[model samples]
Target chain A: MSDLPKILHVEDDPDIREIALMALEVVGGLDVVQCASGAEALERAPGIAPDLLLLDVMMPGMSGDETLTALRKVPQFSETPAIFMTAKAQHSEVDRLKELGALDVITKPFDPMTLADQIISIWQER
Target chain B: MSQGSESYLVSLLGPATAGAVVSLAILLMIGLLARSALGHRRQLRKIREQEDDLALQRKAVDMHAMVKITGVDGRILYANDNLIQTIGYSVEELRGRYASDVFLDEDPRIAAEMWETLRRGDAWTGDNKLRRRHGTAIWVKTTAIPKMGRNGTLDKVITVYTDITDAKLRQQEGPLRAMFDRLQDEVYIFSVDDLRLHYLNKRARASLGWERLNYRSHFLSETTSTFDEARFRERVAPLLAGEVEAVIYESSLSGRPVEINLQLDESVVGEPRFVAVVRDISQRKQVEQARAAFVATVTHELRAPMTSIKGAMKLVASGATGPIPDKPAQMIDLALRNVDRLLLLINDLLDLEKLDNAQTEIRRDPVNLAELIDDAIAHNMGYAQEYGVTFTALPAMPSTLQIVGDRDRLMQVLTNLMSNAAKFSEVGGVVEVGLEDRGDEARITVTDHGIGIPEEAQSRLFERFVQAETAEHKKRKGTGLGLSIVKSIVERHGGRVDFFSIPGEGTTFVIDLPKASDEMSRAA
Candidate 1:
């Protein structure tokens, strides 16, 4: 893995995905590969060899947890750090996502400028 | 002249012939007298025997039944022993009293009807509630027949009463019948053995469109359209077998949603019976659907735009694109602040909705109160700084106080109180958070040195969307649901939340939570 983190962002909403990409790439100066759905992320994840996974909890097909489970099956991505992005900010939901192997859970409508910092903190912790 | 001539001839013929004629005449007279006396004696004996038979029949009726004889004007001429004993009255007390005043209902119409039937010489057979001497009433099944005089006018009424008080009382006292009759929900009772309907309240009859005359004869299967035979049997089998206390299911009856609660009444007299209460829930269901749809639309349509606006504002405020001028920067700052307020309002609205609907489930776990307070202070430190207020953790707080509750919800309560304190505080005011150990409970108090709640608004402080109408509150925009949400969350965790305040001085909020035991901590 390179010094600069390579993140794979999977979100169903095009607007959120585009803004997040700009935040991670332009504002934070990091490499990001964005996918519209979990299925798309799974297909491109092996080729991208991203250092981390940023998955949305509520998605059309293959939820964040389901995608994480599928990715963990692959030997190369077994121990990759993953974080969940969701609108469900309840403490119970956050704890449940953590139990499912997410490094952290970030709530929606997050500060765009600070989003990259939040992700970087999680990456560094990993 | 012929007799004189016959006497002269007889004297001439012989004295013996005259003596024989006299003897024959006397013998004939004695035989006739004897026959008349024998006939008169036989007639007297027959009359006495008939009177004895009538007396015996009257004695038998008086002994076995409650008999009473009333005159034409309803005067109680006589009352049998059974009648006097059952009514708890002496014969002297009942005699000569008007039967209507003694035994009939207090209603004038019923007494009038009884008299009319008797005057018409027709028998009156019905149930009557008669008041006793001691003021208690007894029900009797009565039959009164009018006796006609020689002139064919009604002379007297002979009434026979059989006590039916026990059956009447049982019917009244069984399973709260009076209360069931007054209920709005339809109630029905069915025999467990045959699944036949045994009783239905007035509401049930009216709701099911049943006629009073035929309702009692109808079976449960014919009355309710919601449950077929197989489904009803399946649902009722558990109750009949004492496997479950009650069976509740939602189904439609008469094209409307209804909730049916059925339970077995094993305490009923002969056999176990099933009692079911059916409530129409269409209106409640409609309201729930409308609320759910509104929440979904608000979450989706509103949050999507909010996400974009907040994101764009954050980028502008961060100076990511380019450096902003002074005036523009100030406007951006103000706009961002309002945006944050709007976000808080949205979050508070959702939380209040969830709490009101009881959809928010409290997850109880062992939580360290001291750590939770520290985290709350850290999280709200920015707001305190913005408002030029300081938060001080009083030394009274215990080092390792623990309780069983949902940590997130408790933290939310602390955060709400802290934020409110910061908003209302003077520039140099201090907000203090303290904890006290009280044996089995942990008391958390938040004290803020700021303008306190007005006395008039204090009572309604925890009501949704109610804010004290004051200048400071007007300037500070809020959803007015924070306190209500805090109260709900605290109460759901089996805790109490209360506050004390003095106008223009300060306010202090206290929350008491049960302390966690070692077993509870381990289980959590």
Candidate 2:
């Protein structure tokens, strides 16, 4: 793990992606490569070789967990650490996501200012 | 003793000889008269003793059972006090009325069967559903015996019955029988000895395509797609042996998926029966799948845009992008508050729906009471500050006190309570939270110095959409679902929540949760 890890962020909504770009790159001072969907992330995974995966669940092409399952087939991203952001509030759902080998689950309507720090803390813990 | 008969005797014979013969005749007559008096005295004594015995037997029978005697022509000759009281009819009203008319609910089928049994001279002993004077119906375990006259003529019929209404309720067709008849699930009761169904609710009959009024001849095997008497008996072996209370089976019945839960009813000694409730789950499965899809869509679709909207407003409000003017900042703060409020309402509504639908599974684990309290206080501190109120924890004894509950749900309960206290408290008032360790239970209290709830509002305070109408409470503008959620969460964990409120003074909410048993704690 690096002091500030390079990240691959996938979200369907462009506004959410823009907010994350500002929060991570400008505010938290980290290099973040953004993709609009799981398919785009899969296409770019070989080139990015990111240290961490930031995925948004409930996306268009494939869910965040489903995408993680797919990317694990590639040796480059097989051992990559991932964290999921979800709007689903059920504890059981959260537990299910955790069982899929994610670092942690962050609930939606999150504090934008603290998003970068939350990722960094989880990354360090991993 | 007539003198004329004595004088005739004297004239017929000589005086001395007549006198001697008359004396002998008088002695014979007096001796016969004395013997007749003795016989009368003995008969009187026997009659009094017999009357006493019959009265005692009548009193004993009338105390416990209802008796009715009908003439050979079917007219009621007598109805005892117990029968009159139980049927709610006067003696005059019942006399001369046909027993079937008063007791058989006007069902010709049952009446015909009963009369046939009596005419055949076979005693009819079974459960009879009879209507009372007020049209309220009850079940009586009846036994009818016919008295035979000389030359095989029918003299009369004496019927005795005991009210088995409570016992019959296990079949789900008693006092609420009309409602039971309207149920969606099929209910069947069969004797354990012979697996022959004696009763079927209306739904059961309709679904089984059996429009015939009698279900007594139908066996449990007939209702299933795979009819095997031995296999059916084997399946309910546990319930029959009393090893388990019920047998829950999921199988296809006539190509329809059904859940059959059968329990043994041993209320009638020597006549154990099985009460089976069958529900068609094919329709339920489709409905459940659709409901699950809708809930997921609503949860995802509603939260997605709201997440973006809140994030943007929060970023701007924080001045993370750039410096903002004071008025726009205030406006943004207001928008942010309402956004949070809307989110809270959505979360509360989802939780309520989950609880109502029995979708929320409460996980039981050992939770430290003091630690949970500390966490709740920390979580609600920001909200308390918004109300200019402070939350203080009154230290709990045996801070290591433990309870059996779901940690997340317990946290939710405490957070709701603490936040509610903060919201309703007077500005700068201190809301006290405490936990006490009783022997087998833990007592939790959250007290607030606020505008106390009125007496009338307290009764329905935990109901959905009910909030105190006080100006202070109104200004706080809560979703009014917090306490209800709190109560629901606590109750789901097998705990109780109550409050004592004095208007214009303050309110204190106390929760009592059972402590985790030693075995439970160790096992967990």
Candidate 3:
């Protein structure tokens, strides 16, 4: 409830991270918290309790699917809205993402300027 | 009357004495003539004896005992009918011919020694292979003797040759025995009728730990513990009747496992024989057992985690726990992509495992190489377009270059290479694809003008999960298993891949493959 929407951005790449941050904060006019790895995202989720979460599809150590599995174990994140940023945007791939409880898939090399707006529209529709 | 008779007797006696003188003169002349006639008759008889001796000598020279007579000069003075026939020459042709000409071999020292002995009125005897008039070699035993004068001087040499081709053939058996002794594989020749060993090679003897004569010492039952003599005979009698191509028996001899492959020797008539090759396969059996166990263990371990993870992902994605909100939705999306990546990784790992287990099966068919290239290009064109990279194929490339392969797999290989090219290329950079039709093969090449891979990285580029280690490579990301999988698929299709690249310039990957035929046509 702060009138501003809260968003979580989980990405392994630094460039992708900075771009996603600027897109949410300045362009989409939302409050954003960024994490470098899937483990960090899981750790910060309980404290931050963001309204929407944006995640990169691939990372070392723990994968996004595994991290999401861990997140679903927490009560507060049981029905949170989520989207994935990935380089693969084939229809079969998107269908699989949908099967994993994702609202939509945002293909990577995303126009960082309009990323947060795209997420907001998706969220408001839900 | 007595005085008149006495006077007449004296007159008669004087006349008789004159008459006796005349008779004596005449008798002496006749005796002289008779002596001359007797001497002439004796001379004529000597001439007739000489003529008879010459006729006998000529007849002896014509006889079939392989014979050759030489003079002091070692030149052939006489060659018999048999020697001429065996040496394929006429007596007239051989006479005055050097005796060495008929000898298959003339060792210089032996020839010289022969002449030296014959010069001292001695004889020589030896067996040799003499060259026939037609240049065929014939084995012969020859004897040369020098005929001496009353003064002990060498007059002539008499040589006779006895054909010994059979003995020469027997001499050839020695090398064959030596060859059989040197054989590494077990070889046994048994009389078909008696079912007894006629010949056994050294390897066969050593394996059975028996001598040549002991080959028939033991029956099949002694070596084959699995079956007794009656049963063994029953199983093999049909094979000897030409009912089967071979008889395979795995048995243990002296507690050591042996694999025996018995094949009938059909070379001889009126009798059937067998050739058995025995090999020890105990070690191979042990290794196979160990490998089977390993596969079973690994499959069990991998299946559990995979089932749980996949089932959970499916359930969550299906929204089993009601609807998803905005924040968790993003997390789920990433999870799903990673899951897909994991699935692909698992599939690749399983393929590698199958390769390790020697269970990889390649399904080959006729594929159009040029068409496969098009399909691969089409598959990656969308991704390439996103990067603003133009993939241009040269016009020289044919529309359909045919070769034998697994179609889908080959497409996967080409798509992987193209994917790598598209991912690594800079925005607006040109990627050129080329194809060439060699006689029985086709060559495909992809050239990219983006940041080229380093030589060191190129070496390990086709290794699993190995990515380029350059700054530009980091910008364009991938799973890094593309090249490795591509290489495996290409190699499985019986092809090879090689690439050339200069760091900061460009890279080119070339694939060479055999041409494939159409499925229907191939089956036909």
Candidate 4:
């Protein structure tokens, strides 16, 4: 929508949160807003209206699947390009996430420097 | 008197010489004959007195001594008053009776054997029970001596006997027999030669469901109908031959398999006897089987999730797609670490279950204790440096102190302890490792100057999934099963662990293992 592609990042771990923010914002140079938990992303994603949402698969309170289900309830997010960031990227799990309306999956321990570039390329392909 | 008498005889003879001389000669002859007759009569009277004394002595012996005369065929030929009275038989009734007729039915062979002994010219002397004429049995100790002719041929047997019926009957019901029949356990006496059952207790009869006392004569298969005859005979053969002391077997009774534990009685030497105890263990076997199934289910279920998480992480790290960016890669790293922690937790649980199930078999061999310690220390040193802690091993330790052990498992145990030390220690703290040589054991101790576990936590530290106090420890990440795994692995190796800790000060963990001698080490 804007000159910078809007990206939504959800995470529960503080260290991973800080590292993810730096890699996507400073290194990859992408417009990004961070949510510390799946619950926070559900609450704020509707308001921020991002073009893409990048979600961590595991969180204690609300898992990525649950957050995604909540996001799909919003009318504007129905066709928004979304990707899952998870530790579990098995073939079956990846296929299951795609069926749940996710465009793609990015495994955790991701390279921080190229995270935003990956998001753009996925968005272009979509 | 002789000179005066001679002078007077001479004067009288001159007066009437012829008539006086004839009278004197006749008188002298009569006197001589009278004296000789008196001496013969005195000898005859003395011989008569000696005859009376000999008859009295013969009468006394005949009446006082017990006498029995048996023919060469062991038939009673003659008996004295004492023998007839003791056996409750008249002489007319005792005569021509076979010696075996009076013996008890249970011991008929004894009577036949005793008769054979007498017929062989050897006298039999022993106590035996004989049935009286009134059908009441009396025990008598008899000594029979054979009467022999000048040619050394046996003519008859002269037996002298004493009645011991009352004494022998008293001993028959003595405390020994009472004690034997009163035992609570099933007991039996079996003969080695014929395997004849000689004795059986009330419990043994009840266990076998037998009502007859002569069940002892019945074979084991006959008593236990369900028992496999050949198998039972084979199993008991060893016990009978004195090769095996006891035998244990599981057999079915009323469709339920029962455990039978048979033990030989060692005190009754030369005669074989066995005592068997039957116990029902069907419930225990069922419980064990169920436990094994549960362990298998848990292992399969737990391993599934762990495999998924670990495999996916490995794929992501290898970059099948475009390379991952720094921030996303860091998030992935966080997930990977948590997955690793979960995997460790599962591994620890599975390890404990394996140990509990006795499925964790160790291939034991002679392992150099020094090398084991060195490898463990080397593996942990990098982590120790990362935590800014110093690790030190005491010098002059035996480099070749070998022990019979599973090398890999022992290394794992030592590494776990050292890693725990480094993880719990403050930065720049020191950890010490040392070994002491005991006569039959080696004691390895690991000391760390760390924020030692609190007393309350120390007790639970070796329990599965148990963490220490929440304060100052919440930052550390772990599955909280390291110490438990260490304890289990150590115990499996026939070793034990002990530790002492002071909160906020330091902690020390000691491993005590029996030292393997050089000979044993070489053999292993």
Task: Compare the candidates by lDDT and give the number of the best one.
Answer: 2
**Candidate that beats the other on lDDT, 1 or 3, i.e. the better one:** 1
Q: What DockQ do the predictions score, one after another? A: 0.42, 0.50, 0.01, 0.02
Candidates 2 and 4: which is better by lDDT?
A: 2
Q: What tens-digit string does per-residue lDDT give for candidate 3 at B224-282?
A: 44646566576677686786788887777667676777888654222345666666767
Among the numbered candidates, top TM-score falls to 2
Winner by TM-score between candidate 3 and candidate 1: 1
Q: Which 10 consecutive residues of model 4 chain B have the lowest summed lDDT? A: B265-274
Candidate 1 residue pairs that clash: none
RMSD of 1: 11.7
Candidate 2: tens digits of C-alpha lDDT, residues B1-524? 56887788779886788889888988999999999999999999999999999999989988989999999888999999988987788899889998667755446787678778887788888887777775556788888898878868778999898888757765654555577688899888887777888778899999888877577777877876687777788888878688788898777888888889999876543356788899999977677667666777877787787878888888888887899999999999999989998998988887776665444568878999898888888888897888899988996456889987899888888888887888777889999999998787899999998888878789999999899787766887689888889988888887899999998788999999989988788867
Task: Write one digit per residue (lDDT tens) for candidate 2, span A92-118.
Answer: 888898888889998886777888999
The C-alpha stretches of model 2 lying farther than 4 A from their native spots are: B1-184, B188-274, B281-288, B388-390, B393-403, B436-442, B514-524
**Highest DockQ model number:** 2
> How much is the lDDT of residue A110 in candidate 3?
55
Question: How close is candidate 4 at the interface, in terms of C-alpha RMSD after superposing the true interface residues?
Answer: 11.1
Report the CA-based lDDT of candidate 3 relative to the real structure: 0.70
lDDT of 3 at A43: 86
